[model samples]
Target: MDYQIARHNMVENQVRTNKVTDPLVIAAMEEVPRELFLPEAKRGVAYVDEDIAVGGGRYAMEPMVIARLMQCAEIAETDVALIIGAGYGYGAALLSRVAETVVAVESDKDMTASAEATFQSANYDNVIVVEGDLAAGYPNQAPYNVIVFDGAVTEVPAGVLEQVSEGGRLLAVVRAEGKVGIARLYERENGVIGHRDLFDANIPYLPGFEPTESFVF
Candidate 1:
C-alpha cells in the first residue's frame, strides 16, 4: 500500500475536513510515517479514520481528534510539549515535527520500549518516551508550552495543569463514563488556568485516568 497517498487522504478526508486548519499540524501529520508507530500487524490500518489499539488498553486516538487537539494547542516551533498516554508514540511523533521537544509519558513498560524503538527508527529524536505514572505528567520537565492528553480523561489533575508554563496550553478530550467527550483547550494566563470546549470526541480512556466512583448514602 502507498502510505503516502493514504496519509494524504486521511489528512484531506478525515482531518482537514473536520475543521483542523493549522498548517503546521497538517504538515506534521502528513510527514510522519504513522504506520511505523504501530505493530507490524496493525500497520495496515494505520491511516484508518478510527482509533487503533496499541496495547495496555490504550488507543492511538483518531487522526482527526489528534490533529484537532494539536491544532488547539497552537504549538510553536520552539515550544516544549508533553504528551500523556501517547500510545505507540504517534501523537508524539506528530508533535515532534512542530515543537522543539516533546516528552511522551506512558505507564506501560512494553509500550514505552516499543515507542522508543519506533521513534529511534523513524529518527524522531525530538520526542523522549519515558515510562512512568501517566497522571504525573513527567514533572521533571515541568513548565511545558504544550501539554496534550493523547486520549480521553475524566479529569485533569491540578498538579498536571501546574506543569504548563504561564501562557501555555493544555489539550485533552474530557469525558465521563457513559457520556460523550468534549475536546477542551486549557490556557494558563497570569498563573491562572481556564479552559474552553473545542469539540466533541469519544476516544478511549487512558488507563490511569478513569473517573472515580462516588457513593450515595
Candidate 2:
C-alpha cells in the first residue's frame, strides 16, 4: 500500500478535520511513518481511523486522538517529553520532531525492542526508549517539560503528575468503567497542578492502569 498517500489522507481527513490545528503536530504526524510502528500484518491498516492493537493489551491510539492530545500539550522545540505506554514508539517518533528529547517508556519487552529498533532505524536520535511499569513514570529523568499517556487510563497517578516540571503540560484520556473517556490537559504552575478537559475520546485503556472495582454493600 502507498503509506505516504494514506498518511496524507489520514492527516487531512482524520486529523485536521477533527480540530487538531497545531501545525507542528500535523507536520510531525505527516512525517512519521505510522505503518513502520505496526506489525507487518497490521501495516496495511495503519492509517485507519480506529485504534490498532499492538499486543500486550495496548492499542496504538487513533490519529485524531493523538494529534489532538499533542496539540493540547503545546509541545515546544526545547521541551523534554515523556510518553508512557509508548507501545511501538510511533508517538515518540512524532514527539521527537518538536521536543528536544523524548523518553518513551513501555513495559512490554518485545515492544521496547521494536520501539528502540524503529527509532534507531528511522534516525530519530532524540527519542530514548526504556522498559518499566506503565503506572510509574520514568523518574530517572524527572521533571519533564511535557508528558503524554499514549493510551487511555482509568485515572492519572499522582506520582506521574509529580514528574511534570513547573509550567509543564501533561495529556491523557481518562475513562472509567461504563463511562466515556475525556481527553484532559494538565499543567503545573507555581507548584500546583491543574487540569481541564479538552475533548471526548474512547481510546482503549493501557494495561494495568485501570481503576480498582468498588463493591456495593
For residues 44-130, write the lDDT of model 1, one tens digit per residue: 999999999866687878999999889888889999999998778889999999999999998888889999998887788888999
Q: Which ten residues in a row have the lowest lDDT in candidate 1?
A: 53-62
RMSD of each: 1.1, 0.9
Q: What is the number of backbone collisions in each predicted candidate, taken in the order shown? A: 0, 0
Summarize candidate 2's per-residue lDDT along 113-212 as a digit string, tens digits.
9999988988999999999998999999999999999998898999999999999999999998988999999999999999999889998999988777
- Give the residue spans of candidate 2 off by over 4 A: none
Candidate 1's displacement at residue 132, Å, is: 0.5
Give the C-alpha miss distance for residue 185 in model 1, angstroms: 1.0
